[model samples]
Target: MRVTIFILLVFIPLTSFSALRFKEVFYFSERSNFSDSHYRNQRPPYYFPGNFAKEQRVEPKRWGEGEAELMEEALSELLSLPQLQKMFLFLARKGPVALKRFAEYPGRVPGGLGRMNQGDKKIGSVKMWAAEQPSFYVGVTDDFFKYMGHLDREKQVKVAKYIGLHELSHLYDYRMRFSFRDQQFLRATGWKWAWFLRRWENQYVPEEKRRALMKKVEEGEMSLRDLDRIVREQYGLPSFYSVTNPKETFAEVLAAYVLVPEAKDFLRPEIMDFLDGILNN
Candidate 1:
């Protein structure tokens, strides 16, 4: 029985949602779960920013100093988490094996490039770069540490840890699971679609010139409804991509699970059912 259970654990492609569900139950069972205790210990006195501009300003220099400190602290704590350590080990082994098989195909993967890097300009948010060898670079801005510090410290740390885990998952996937050839195929598909759209746009008549054509498309004049169809159509693409790729979908699900327990309540019925399936499987 023990051998069977161990084999199941090793072979199963445990979804992020499933892992989170297990974590929830495990943490609940443990008397010293850090959720409440961590928060209570780290609570800080209130101090709100005086103005909107003050809040919006980006200061990379300042953020760098704080980010470094936070990163060190977070890394230390992360290394100590047994569950996270185990997950990392599993991914380290599993990711490369998956990638090797994927690399044999001469097509772009269904999802966009699975990796990204920090560019010359420091953007506040992380960005993805599609390349022969995809990699992710965590962007740190001046407000990074300050913003994190401002969070209900205990709650925020948990959030940060979750974010780190999610990003790490991506790293593992790219290193082991994603293939350059697959990405190239997907990129070609995207280009073909872009070309089709451009041709379609150019064929519009004089009465439906650029502005008018844009307005019409914006108003969904071409589609079944005369609503803002273009934006709506574009909005759904991410959902499709999320569904097709387990890595992307899992990372997102895991991030949400770690940061927001309330998310389980708000998820779509289909998604909730999916999560249940992952957990039970």
Candidate 2:
């Protein structure tokens, strides 16, 4: 079956605003061959192949009964925002993004995963896998439903949209090669890249404070997670995972600024302003 996708562009002119507003319309058929198919034989601890161009073309997996509908709703809501729409279009310009599902893949996480294979776009007349096409593989495991069991349909959709936006934010950051301005902005929150160590380091706290925490952890006075949490909390990061690296911090903050209603209070004003400049400009 062919993959089906439809987009409706609505232009609304505002008296006060010079730019027009647009709403994204997405429709995905149940028979769409968009889901990933490389994991049929793979078992637990699935490893996503970094490059998608070399994978064999197998029958793509179909979504569970209601999964497609949920994803369609989620995508429509997510692209309604101008920032997200811009991001999607920017990536599409490099190469069309393929949406795939991870169907009950053992040990699969219950969220969206976005990856980009960066390479050349074309060799003569043929488009190459070297093109920077971003792919999104969404997984909705039983744990996802159990966690959202209490929320109504509308709320559940919101949660799904939030997760989708989070993953898209990652792709956007990747496509931009993690902008230097963004890196500088987040540096204030205590995330830094160590050239010598060749990894991200948490410098949010003072050296003295971190040393003290290390001593406590060594003495069994505090757990390592606790030490990390303390530094993350000092900057009011959205979650502990956000502090994993500057890229994650960018994704987490951007997602919150766009979807979370109370994000203005939770995130620092400077961070929100930075996102506004990037998305709007």
Superposed by TM-score, candidate 1 places the C-alpha of residue 67 at a distance from the truth, in angstroms, of 5.7
Evaluate all candidate structures by whole-model CA lDDT and list the values in order.
0.33, 0.50
Model 1 residue 177 lDDT score: 46
Q: Judge candidate 2 at residue 174 and give its lDDT.
A: 68
How many angstroms is residue 121 displaced in model 1 relative to the true structure, after the best TM-score fit?
A: 19
In candidate 2, which residue pairs get closer than 3 Å at backbone N, Cα or C atoms, i.e. clash? 119-130, 190-204
TM-score of 2: 0.57
Best by lDDT: 2
Tens digits of per-residue lDDT, candidate 1, 143-243, equal 33433333323223353555555565465446544312234322311211235444321111221343454454335454212222232243221122233
Top-TM-score candidate index: 2
lDDT of 1 at 85: 48
Off by over 4 Å in 2: 1-60, 104-157, 179-181, 205-233
Q: How many residue-pair clashes does candidate 1 contain?
A: 12
lDDT of 2 by residue, 1-281 (tens): 99989889899976642221222222232222323344544543334354432233323255567866655655666666666656766755643444444333322222211110011111111101111222332334333333322332311234455555666677677678653345556554566666887766766554455456556755668654565446435666654446656776777778777876656666766776677777877
